[model samples]
Target: MKAREAVSRVLPATIACLVACAKPQGGGPPRVEIRPSDCAIPSQPLLRGIHSIVAERAMSCAVLDQGQVACWGVQDLGRLGDGFEVKRRDLPTRVPGLQGVVAVTQGNDATFARMADGSVRVWGPNRGGEFGDGSPDYHIAWAPRAVAQWGTIKQIAGGIPTCAIRSDDKVVCAGRARFRRMNEDTAAPGGTPVVVPGLESAAGIAAGSGFTCALLGEGSVWCWGMADAGQLGNGGGEDQDKPVHVRSLDPAVEIDAGSDTACARLAGGGVRCWGRSFAGYGLDHPEKWLRPVEIKGTRDATQISIGDRVGCALLRDSTVACWGESSYDGQLGDGSDETRGTVAGPVACVRDAVQVSVGDNHSCALLRDGTARCWGSGTYGAVGDGTHEIRKIPVAVLDAVEPAPDAERCPPGTTFKRGKGQDDLEAVAEWCETPDGKREGMYVGRWATGQKLQQGGYVSGVRHGEWTRYYEHGEVVSKDRYEHGEPHGVWIAYSLHWRFAFASCFDHGRRVWQVSSEAEANQKRCP
Candidate 1:
């Protein structure tokens, strides 16, 4: 059967069978309801053999096991590394003719894998030469093809572009040269890989959203690509197509990149960051840091991973600390939705966190004991817990296995955090709160500044009057006369203790008259 037909014919029955087989241990089966009526399918005998694999968002993911690799998600650009841009496959599918695979890396729309023999295979989104096959068009490599020019490949990284280092300590990259374009007179299309100049003996490489960096044997760093956001770490806004030394970075051991920033781990077990600070991913300051700024007071950093808007560091003590945009589902793990402009406090998700990976909207931490925990946006099953639920706290992802004839049902207090595409505000809010009342006052919604509160004005927090004035700093400037939080009469404002600044008459929060006085007019103009 065709892929779509096969999915349509198989999905309903598989869901029903799985639902029916799941019964609470020590009790009768709980109520199971399949809704939307039209999409329902009856259980069939053949469906019993099928199983479903759940993921958070279908980006690009790969798993390496026993020298073999399997990948899935968004293959429109051939990112699945399956040798063809057929379509998206929701489940993990093995790449044809690939074996002895040891490691795999994914880009926004491309994929690359390395073999035990030190050979590399690339496939999927080739819009830029991210595939390193010297082609501009997306090429699906169904089988492992030897990169004849690159030998003894030791490490590889991917982003909007792709880069890899050979065992002999040479570096190469492919994709749009965002940093290089900043200096060149011509627009360079992303396709065709290029050699990064000035680094003849590099030991490692890391790629960001639009840039790439490398670590040399001498403990220095070089980077290139989109520096518009200062991702190149050169302490300047100019983009560098060729590799240039990153200023103020020393004793560097490892590096990682985000959508618009990069982080490096020093030999002393400390961490430093450069690039966009809008989400606090960069160092705290008014000016963009071109040089590395040591993360204040952190001295045990062992590993680091950069996300689209957040960056996380793993300490030698096995503790994890994250900062940067914590607004979207608390991906920063600060126990609040407030956007942190710097590395806040460390989080206590698990002990002995041996590995970590940061996605665009979520993060994953792997325990030394083989258990994995994830947090952030679950709109696309990115949390991989069998449901589309946004989780402010970490949730466990159960390994996929065939359902038993009598499986246990979901436990009490267990509720699926509805996916992002699904509308369920209550569920989303509940997940954003900490068990202890820490995040109670926070609300994740929209607001319009400088707008008058109407009769039916909505406020997430406390509001004492209908015509409340606010300072430019988001603080409550003053409260006007009110009757049950609705404006009733003339209101006056004062700057200091007895110094009247402004006066205004209002009818139910709508301004009606302003006193013709200099002080009142000045307050209205400034406040």
Candidate 2:
């Protein structure tokens, strides 16, 4: 076929499949390559049968086929989650205290895992309250801790702020008060997780350094938080505390949020990106993109990931394409430490990649054979190749695995439990007293762990009057009014920071109206 004719025949399908069918994953022999002197060869064999991979600021975490978790990268602040005793790892190491993990993610200073039970666990620094456990004096979770009572969680993403999506499609986020829960009182330090009000029916969620974007079940996208660089994709340079729809882009199959930028893969296999122009998706401006723009000459994008100043796309043909900001670090995996301009093109020497993840200054691809390869900045061993040297070409990661699954059981160990309590008042430490300070005949109370089992006036063991649920930090996580054992008046939910997540008015146990915040309630004249 003539090259010109071939190009003309597939006008809209910019990607040309070099082979009739992209070869299935995991067939080729490991490519022979020289080892860098800075990296020490691993003593163990590479673990096979990998499943998924994710990266954060300068670390990477992966889930094995048998549901174990492994991680590597800068060891500061417990980013690797290997424990406090071991500070750094140049190759993949099993993250202690995690098992039956279905999904894993990393942030600038933390790591997260979604276990099979739908619960989420967090480790590393709790600065800005990213831990979501609602502890007041805790600074770091050197060991992973269960995130209170969350369950049915499907997806997790980390960044400046961290976020996750529940199986029910509701979005919850912790850390970073910039996207403060609309309004209640003061911005609470992120000591717990709270629902991102106004977001529902979401399929996936991604967090950037300061912003967040969610892909809805119907293929539309919504973004909130910082937009000074047009990262919100709402065609305006205004920060959105609530999700704003990305203009014109729809039927999005997947979405990724990066530092000051975001990208989405459409149903038809085209990819559109908005925000920082360094993504090289071919928008005219080199500074910001206020709306989604197509990367010229790209198609069949099954997945797209964005990083600090780079972006990569995994096409259906098993090959990868990358563009943007490769001048100093060869993160593009294209055999050169040079920029690829505003257009996305193929990366050389990598094929049969089943999945790919991009971090701040590096990139990784998981091949069909269950092996992983990484390239670019190796600072602090972010490359997972046991090296501090930059890799312009793809290099193998130490294949590593964790212990096999035992049986269904609770995660052992309990130094602290943040946001965990029973609904009943069986272990009441103190009962609720009336306004006059008289102990009520029957009332809710606190547990020995300081978690409020129930907090409300009760008569005949039935709830009445004002009620509240307190997180471990002594902040009211939720509150509502009750009358004669029936829900009545206004009800409010707060994030870990004690900011209003949402509020609703109820009458005789029936919800009458709801608002995202106190300001929104005031605007609507909700009494």
Candidate 3:
């Protein structure tokens, strides 16, 4: 249940159906007094890859070593598809015509790609069918189709009734109507793609939030639609349209799920999990296991992520371990948000690791030299590290391919120098370009020994007037006022001995109240 709680209020996944879905980005990323009215929408920020990470919910898309794919968080209903929909995009854009690409998934609203000729595409705002193509829409598709004849596919799983695994392994699914009942003798065709009844050879698939699982090549795993928390481990909570065989677990090579929990990866590597949501594996509250358990010291592992609030594993020495619910938001990257003790520890700064995903409260890892690291909640920037702040441990993913190389190149932003300056203290960062780059004026950021940390006044890229944030040693951690990017006047935020930690007032960018003293934000105003 710790997917960062904060649904504030609900009713949307196209009329919610009461629960099988309805959780779109709802309010969970601003602390200190917590005025939250329930924001909803659920996600943001992620970049992976020596090659992979397509985390969904609020948004984040990756897959590049050259196979291009970019995306940032919450781009309104177009969800950062990159065809310009505006509302949010803290950076990372590309997603135009796509190319060679090999994977990506984002479900609950669309964004699926799996090409390299095998073909499969799908774009945003797809109502419930989430582009499984069963014909659900509310406008906003904008572009991105290809889901035709079905064959050559290979593997795809974008939760809530979205599956694909062909090339003869057979397994087709599309959106939901509870997956068209698979078959009890043909009553099909209501939403679209069907065939699951006998789940032919499958071999791999994972989708959650409305159920769907598969692994069989004899390793056995089969699951199907919403079991109300037991996450269909087969022990049962009751909601099935067909497939149900998790009992006693089996050969399993690797598997995953979140939003009701699920984990697997034992052929000897060991690491089991079952749903209804995490709560320390030795168990205390989230009951519903029904079967799959394992998790003690978690063995050799080799990958498993399950996040809606922590459940990592990637061992075999690559290192990574996680338990559950870190007090409130750390999602257990470990640096400190405290809360562990059912055995899986170490996740503090990350290392050799090769891949890990977990999203819905943040977690990302993908290092083996190709670099990537992310920690809990960075909101619309989802910890991609360009800064939206909040990271507890694990940072460093400055656009992963841009912004580093000594910095200096601000088309949209980035500029840091090493030499050639009015006393180049070795820390020179400045942004605010124009001359066709669109932005103009000033945006400083320093720290490589120079220490300015943040300055303000950006133009076309928005952020107007005074802003300041520092702490590399110069103290003063935040004193805001923006007009272009909204949030006008007095925003505060500081606490490392300097005090205040909250003080807000804003105007153009909204916020009308927030206090922790600037004398309680100057006695309060806005009414």
Q: Which model scores highest in TM-score? A: 2
Q: Weakest 10 consecutive residues, lDDT, candidate 3?
A: 15-24
Give the per-residue lDDT digits (tens) of candidate 2, residues 491-516: 55443344444555645333456554
TM-score for each predicted model, relative to the true structure = 0.59, 0.66, 0.31
Pairs of residues at least 3 apart in sequence or in different chains that clash in candidate 2: 26-368, 26-369, 47-399, 129-190, 188-497
Candidate ranking (TM-score, best to worst) = 2, 1, 3
Instruction: Compute the lDDT for candidate 2.
Output: 0.60
Q: Which RMSD does model 2 reach against the true structure?
A: 19.7
Off-target runs (Cα >4 Å) in candidate 1 are 1-62, 70-78, 81-98, 140-149, 178-192, 278-287, 402-527
- Give residue 390's lDDT in candidate 1 (0 to 100): 68
Q: Is candidate 1 or candidate 3 better by lDDT?
A: 3
By summed lDDT, the worst window of 10 consecutive residues in model 1 runs over 1-10
The lDDT of each candidate is 0.50, 0.60, 0.56
Better of 2 and 3 by TM-score: 2
